[model samples]
Target: MGQPPLEAEIEIAATPDEVWAAISNVAAMKKRSPELVVMRTFGKPKVGRRSVNINRRKGFAWPTTARITRWKPPTNDGGNGSFAFYVWPTDVEWSYDLEPSSTGTRVVERRTALPDPSLSVRLTAKWALGGADNHDTELLAGMNATLAALKVEVEQP
Candidate 1:
């Protein structure tokens, strides 16, 4: 079977628009994401927009580029929305989804399953990232941490 998608979710005591505000802001996301050190977007964020990202793991750092594939901000105060990007090198898509909930909003972060990573990506994962499985485990944990941090930030007064 193929690898399962990496996912993590959290409920925040804030509206969907409020959550979208945080999720859509690439600058703010850099602060929330554990692996993301820098994310520079060209102009405003929209579908088809491009970004340069620098990710770090301990002493290892790598540069990657991505294109925004989806950008649907909440249409109304309590509407659902999603944002996604297609990342190069790994050929994976990462996304964030927001849904209105009873208490406030439910935020979900997801990374597409990587069943056939490129040879270069495979080697880099093995050498620099402590193997694919281990790195995926860390990525799941990072997703959880990122969602938890976002919850804290969005729920703040």
Candidate 2:
């Protein structure tokens, strides 16, 4: 079976459009993401756009590529909005969803590892990258950190 998606959420004291403005700058991810060392986009962030990322953990750094598959702007009323990308050279999809709330905006980050992982990818994730549970735990923490940083950025006056 495919691994369950890992997710984290945080409320930012900003509207959905404000939140989207901060998160949609995929090329600037390295500045906000705790684990992403670098990210470079080939074109504007939109469905079908490609990007490369380098992530680090415990002194180890690895590279991955991804293609944007979904890109939806927040509604004018500050309702739900989301964008997602599929990581290549592996079966992983990462996404961010935003929803307006009474306090401000709720931002959710998700990571889904495709169920039909190639043997090579599975082994790499299990052994080289730490076991599945360990990796998921780290990812959750990173997502929380990323969202917290973003909240601070968007809430600033």
Candidate 3:
């Protein structure tokens, strides 16, 4: 089987539009994301657009060129938000739902299983598992950290 998906949520003291603006910008993401050292794209990223995210400490790159599933603005209750981060071999889908309230906006990010990757999962089966180092656990932790940082950045001036 492919790698299991991870889910996380973070509340931001900002409107959905504000959060979207900050999160959508590749350059801006480099600053908001705790684990994402830097991200850049030759051009804009759309449905078939591609981008790269590099980890500073790991000194490794996790390249993903995913198609945008839902790019519509947030609904009254926050409904239309999802993206699939993919590597030719496999991909992870992240769907976000933001709900507005008196406090602020509640952003929920869900990492779901990739239906069928471009490549066979068997090729990297061994590396996919979370061994002693626990890559899977680490991924979730990183996601949480990134979301937390994002919340702070969006809420602050």
Best by TM-score: 1
The TM-score measured for candidate 2 stands at: 0.90
- Per-residue lDDT over 20-107 for candidate 2, one digit per residue giving the tens place of the 0 to 100 score: 9989988667888878998888978889988888988777788889899889989744478898999977678899999989998999
Total backbone clashes of candidate 3, pairs 3 or more residues apart or in separate chains: 0
Name every residue pair that clashes in candidate 2. 2-115
Which numbered prediction scores highest in lDDT against the true structure? 1
Error of 2 at 69 (Å): 0.9
Q: Please, what are the lDDT tens digits per residue for candidate 3 over residues 1-157? A: 4456678888788877777766666567666555566656557755566666554435434544444554545543353344344434355666566667566777776767645444434433334442313655776787788788888878787
Q: Give Cα-based local distance difference scores for all models.
A: 0.90, 0.84, 0.60
lDDT by residue for model 1 (1-157), tens:
2356899999999989988988898988888889999989999999999999999999999999999999998874338999999999888899999998999998899999886877888888989999888999999999999999998888888
lDDT of 2: 0.84
Q: Show pairs that collide, candidate 1.
A: none
Prediction 1 global C-alpha lDDT: 0.90
Question: What local lDDT does model 1 show for residue 136?
Answer: 91
Task: Give the Cα RMSD of candidate 3.
Answer: 3.9
**Rank list by TM-score:** 1, 2, 3
Model 3: residues with Cα > 4 Å off, grouped in runs = 53-62, 75-87, 114-133
